[model samples]
Target: MNPYSVRTLWISDLHLGNKDCKAGFLLDFLNKHDAETIILVGDIVDFYSMKSSHHWPESHSQVLSLLMQRAHNGTRLIYIPGNHDAVIRQYLKFNFGHVEVRASHIHETLTGKKIIAVHGDEFDSAVCHKRLTAIAGDVGYDLLLFLNRWWSRARQRMGFPYWSLASYIKSKVASANVAIQRFENAAIQYARRKGAHAIVCGHIHHPDMKVLGDELYLNDGDWIENCTALLEQHDGTIQLIRWTERCELLAESYAFASLQPDAVSEKKDEAA
Candidate 1:
């Protein structure tokens, strides 16, 4: 990637097989922005459940083509498989157009900032600990996606913006919060130990950018909730962006490898 004119974008948890994947919005975004590099942090596909019985959608295929087009047009793309699509990691050496697959990687920004990028499933003890909970979660998430799709579509007819009902409910569940917190803590600690200034990941479906001591932690969030992403610019600046009724900026801060709280503040005050 060209450091002088290129920007690096990271996104994850797209869950392509789910009806609520929001491929239209994502495709629109890609068509509008010409990034120099794009990183799919993880779970770009919900293969775990997708392989069972659900049929694929045309919108999903369009989104994939859009991405491939960008790669063909000189935009560098990298994909890291998440828990939902962990099997893809087996083909780490493969490349599709300009897109490459990697189990995990270290990204060094133009400004000399170093960060590790991963899908974040390894940090989730429940996902790694047991087979049953993981299966249950996948099934539940799929059902929620089904309802979210039809419900949000109906909402659109009623003049409402798209939103994930499943995500909203998950936020209110205490068990989910506990699980998220545990995962976040693990990622932060791992970054600090690896001597990285920050760690970037996707999973947990929450968008956040935090500075913890000398290390930083960033979760791109997911299409299911915030529909957000993280961008690293050549000037060493890092930004967290959210896509809603349209594209929006959520937060921006310096590129520090350590997870530092308060390093980046949500610019909700600037929302129009």
Candidate 2:
């Protein structure tokens, strides 16, 4: 297949320093696609996990190196710090090896639509106001991801395709659904406040492309679980793609529907 090129690519929740991070898959995805602009929406590195366990593997290092190489190759790179790697927030506005760090950015699409790019943690009440609860939740989430890794390996042994155990649990859990709804509402409202036509973010780990009234809400999902991303075409159309399904879908000559102005709540829901 020929190399695929895009106008913009948004990805996040890599949690690179964590044991469960799927760095090999991410590296493959990056190698397959090239973009004019790349947005690291947040939680690209699991600093909290690294601080606790100091588990930085060669795979994680390779991921970082590849990103820097891309930047050096003239791709405009933007890094927005998320809660897990929030320490980088201190160096906001600094440029490191062609990558610009920022709290948020306003991206103008080819069609003149203004999209607000942020990590989306600021709108998460648990992360913002309930510190203890948030930390507890993070611990639980880590355990879930650990289990998911084992579960996925077992499935692979059985010759089954990749599936997200954590994502399935999140969808079935009532509280998780409520939290996701709240996060989505908060993100849309924040975009409105910023006077942006749309908002692209990653934190909830739910990939979606929805039109709420007149504005759009997009999430790039995560590398740790869903292995998904949000891509903007040269014509300003956006697509939420799952890397795990790419091979099968490409065999069928799949083409995603373009973003429509009047469309309401279209989503490519990923496992949490």
Leading candidate by TM-score: 2
For model 1, the superposed segments whose C-alpha errors exceed 4 Å read 1-6, 126-140, 255-272
Alpha carbon lDDT of each predicted model: 0.73, 0.78
Q: Residues 1-272, candidate 1: write the lDDT tens digits.
A: 22223378888988898656777677655655567888899989888658775957898898888889878988888999998888887889798667799987788877567788888877756334343243225667667667777888899999988777877777777666666666677888888777776798887777887766567778888876567778775566787877667556666566444322235555531322
TM-score (all chains, Cα) for each model: 0.83, 0.87
Where is model 2 more than 4 Å wrong at Cα?
126-137, 245-272
Model 1 backbone overlap count: 14
